[model samples]
Target: MQSRPSPVPFPAASAFPKALSWVLVACLGAGLGIVALRPGQAIPAEDTPMEAVAVVPATVTALGALEPEGETLGIAVPSSAQGSRVEQLKVAQGDSVEAGQVLAVLDSYEVRRAAAVRAEQDLRVAEAQLAQVEAGAKNGAIIAQQAEIQRLNADQQARIASQEALVNRLVAEENNAAVELGRYSKLYDEGAISALERDSRQLTLEAAQQNRQQAAAELVRLQSTESPQLLAAQATLAQIAEVRPVDVALAQATVDRAQAGLQQALVDLNQTVVRSPRSGVVLDILAQAGERVDAGGNLLELGQLTQMAVRTEVYESDLQRVAVGQPVQVSSAALPQVLQGQVVRLGWKVQPQSIITTDPSATIDARVVEVQVALDEPSSAIAQRFTNLQVTVEIDTQ
Candidate 1:
């Protein structure tokens, strides 16, 4: 009876629980198998909404390419010959110039005027000196001196002739007295004359002897004095004739001094007119007309821009790769144009760190070397277009 009661209670338990569980399990396994066996398929936009995101492709390059090592240098306009205020400006900015061309001129009015004055003064002084030398003397003084010399000569000759005549007269008187005395002496000797007559004849002979001796002395004196005076007068005339040579030398010296002064004045005048020392284009004009300028003052700036050069700094790591004569490519951030250039030189030393970047991680304390690159083919047109333009230079490491 008990066993029958227990079977009756279990019968009311689950309603086909085992059979229903098996069916559900089979259905789930088949559904999972169909899902796994089907080919992979993308979910449709309509079925599952997807996010609309714009994706950009990433560039594959080295970190060095992203931030290449380069240098930025200041633009320099070449200098011209330092001068004073510009009196004349021949060319303007952006003008093509040749070698030895005159670009500007300083004030030359004063210089030219001074030069003219000096030239005129030189000529006038030279002419005056020449005329003075040619004139010989003022107020006919030389002519009067010649006349006086002639008169002195005539007087000396007349005196000499008078003295000679006196000597001849004295000699004649002495001869007559001598003959009378001789006759008286012979009468006395022959005993035909008295003692008184003999004494008187001896006295006359003694007196004639004395007179002859005096005349001879007078003649000697006249000859000596007259000849010397005549010779002296002739010597004086000869000296006068040679005086013109000395006068000519003095005049020539004066002319030379005048010429030297004129030359110095001309040099000073030329300094006032400042001319260009070389041929180049004017880059800057610091002075103008009517502006006072001192010597060596900066007046203008000139430069040769036909050929350009770039100065860049390379990192210490990449410095070994750079060398002289290596080819380089130059580009400008603003222009974005490429230029061909070659390395002309390399720095021997290194430079200090720069403070351009604030990132501590980006900054390096390592030294940098400078490199100079010259354009292979430079043109005036290109230079003018890109004058003072900032450029970036790149050197191949491989």
Candidate 2:
């Protein structure tokens, strides 16, 4: 029976086998071509209509670092202080500090403190002197000066009175001698007195006149000297009784000089103790006890870790999409959870990227703009401990 069927015309079976083989080959070739072309075309969503699919908002992604609200601060010694050594450290790493709180004491502390103390004493002394001058002479001194003036006036009056009395007595004697001389001359003329007696009377009258003249001249000289003495004593009393403007000014100037000295001393003394410029936590100590610090050299690293932020270096091409108040997403390997923030600032300059990746294929020469994102309170609290940690930032630019 098989021999009989084969012998019969079996063209349909042979044709079917050949056609099936060709069709199978074509199907395989078409599938290979479709797979080859698939890489160049976007894959269509399965079981979803293109019109109903939602459009994703555009975003700018960049590498960034976690920082404090203001950023990490390098606390250093005053510029004016050079080659200063740390004597004592009042804080340790991770210590919370307030603004203006003393962080360390320098070796110059004791010397500067002593200088300040001396300056303060000098200021007090100068102030006292100024007060004394402004108040004029003491009450007791004024009283004593007034009493001396009065005493001088009384002495002058007594001397003048004594001189006047002597002059008056000498004038009386001269008058009597003149009368006696007249009488003796008349007697001599009348030949009633001897020549020797008349001569002796004349001599006595001349002597009396000379004595009166001498006494009058002495009284005038005494009055001139005594008047000036009394006037000088009165001037001395007046000078001590009232405050003089020139004297007060001189005393006040001394006080001002002392005050300035004290202020300078205080400033120098304050420089001996390094204080926190802001409220923050100490991230690290750059200079330890017994270590020397140069001008502008760091003493410690500090940050306001209570409020955290992310500093993103957005590509210049994507910077146009970034703006203040835009929502941002920050992620880091060190962080347990994603952090949320909003763009608060955008850089005005475009510079070379600072955040370098370990990946050799990463674009290292790309220019970027700094974008500052302020984290929410909860995010900040969580990210504070990871300051300066590298992170990935995504900014939604819908």
Candidate 3:
């Protein structure tokens, strides 16, 4: 009751402080809003204290797949061994192999091996013949050859003398026949001789001329050269006296030819066996024993699993954001945790995206550039088993 009586109109001055507090609160909110909305705006020093803003690193993301350092390799038969079937597989899938290690043998192995053996035998025979030639003729052979040469020379002289005597006798007979023919012709022209007698004289003259010509040719042949037997005996004697360079050269040439043949045969034999070109693991075997290699002749698929990498296909538009040596993060449902890597290369060509996403809204026809990211050691060990596994990649652009 006393308070009601004393209740006077609230003073404007008393309400001034409360109204001032409400106005101050509103001004504070407006200042904070201005600072947040326009960060570049200058604030009065006497107003609110400034706070630091956090910054986040930017990133680019794309679909990717895990692979060996240099990607998978389809090991094929040597081109020289085309059309050959596999006779044996020395290594199976999952086996590790070193460069030049035998992985398979072709059907031509045994045949080629036999050919090589024959070539080797030929080489040995050639070498023996070369040694025999280089050693020169033995003393007993030299004596026999000299005696044969003397005998042939004596026989040639006697034959030449005999042929000369025969030539002289035939020449005399030819002259006599010519004189008789002249006489017969004169008699025939005078009609003093019978036609049969004239014909008989002509035949006698022709036979005499033929005999004379044969004798002359035989004499010339005898005088012109030594007997072939005599020449051969002389050659053998010369070879016995000293090893002729020509003979040695001929034998050496034979040896060289045999060696070349052996080399070629060995090369062909080696071709029958397929060897690895590099150290790697055999991921698959495309050809088995008794199986004919395909058109490509691929024998197996192999790769170096020691180091792993991610091949990411980034959109062409975002390619500018990627660079070599940049850090990367790779993740996949197949992996237990995120993996770390570094960008190592960028593709030179822009190609259509090959990896399709499960999300229907994704850009299926996006043009992309392949970017290679090499994984760290630990990450590589983890990814070794996941070759060709699709993965998500995040590249730090900062």
Candidate 4:
């Protein structure tokens, strides 16, 4: 039996046995490869297809920021409302507003309103005065100088008459005193009256004479100076109408002054209520109701977001390849889709790159030219959602 086993070992050493061993080795490798690749599993990188046709030609890439086509319009509190506390705020951030729409109210409105009312009252008073003067001029041509003159003459005559009466009384008193003095002197010579009584009568006669002289002088003054003054006043009255041109002008001036004051008060009152200067969306709220702010201080920010553009900075070296009206592709990590646009403007000068990336490995310093790309309609719809957001722009310079 051992001899027969030796004879079978001869087949194991044959060429067919060697071929079978090679086949086994090949089958094992095939099985191992099959095991490595299950259904729905990814193929090895080496097995992936790398062949592709020429698609995108050449492009100039740049970094940029998104913005409205007209750029942001910065809005602040009205200069007239500076240094006032906000009493009422009608809108908040992100609220859309129209031109001249009230955004907030200042606490000084009550004061401004009071001033306006006073100015209006003053204006009315001036207007009424002017109207009264005009009416007088129309109704009465000129003041009656004759009537004024007659009144003055009458007053002068009355004064003159009173002086005459006083002179007559003093003359009669003087005559009486003289008679008494003579009687007293004669009695003294006869030694019938005392020396004291004779001296008293002499003093009484002197006093009566002095009084008559003063009364006569006063009557003369009234007839001369008083009559002339009355005549002069009558002459002046005759020269002017009921209301002179100068008077009218003064009244008109008062009206003008009142008008200016009223206008100023109205302006101040309008300023008390802050209004939006443009139609747009509110971007940020810098102040709230009941907050006090200084003149010209910022209270909020607004912008037009529906229509937007991309402000890009291209390499100076690539300036020649890029031009206005060139088509562009804009992309951003903040968004999911690639947006389209066209270059609307080219920078006239070259400057340092302003689009610095947050990545530490990014190149921050480079000479670049600023470019403005206007977004297309479909792209604008997407751009409106990301104002001031940084983006990558690719201009097809091919």
Which has the greatest lDDT?
Answer: 3
lDDT for model 1: 0.62
Q: What is the per-residue lDDT of model 3 for residues 17-123, given as tens digits with 9 covering 90 to 100?
A: 99899999999999887868656777557867888899754999999999998989998887888889899999988899999999999999999999999999999
Candidate 4 deviant stretches above 4 angstroms: 1-57, 137-241
Clashing pairs in 4: 82-295
- Writing each residue's lDDT as its tens digit, candidate 1 over 188-275 gives 8899999899888778777877877887787778667756666676666665555487788878887887877777776655554544
Global lDDT of each model?
0.62, 0.90, 0.91, 0.86
Give the TM-score comparing model 2 with the true structure, all chains together. Answer: 0.76
lDDT for position 376 in model 2? 97
Q: Candidate 3: give its CA RMSD in angstroms.
A: 13.8
The list of candidate 2 runs beyond 4 A from truth reads: 1-60, 164-193, 216-228, 320-326, 396-398
* Tens digits of lDDT, candidate 2, 208-250: 8999899899889887776777788788878888888999999
Model 2: lDDT to the true structure: 0.90
Worst 10 residues of 2 by lDDT: 1-10
- Which is the leading candidate under TM-score? 2
**Cα-based RMSD of the predictions, in order?**
12.9, 6.0, 13.8, 13.6
Candidate 4 global lDDT: 0.86
TM-score-superior candidate, 1 or 4: 4
What lDDT score goes with residue 277 in model 2?
87
Sorted by TM-score (best first), the order is 2, 3, 4, 1
The TM-score measured for candidate 1 stands at 0.53
Which structure is stronger by lDDT: 1 or 2? 2
What is the full ranking by lDDT, best candidate first? 3, 2, 4, 1
Backbone clash tally (model 1): 0
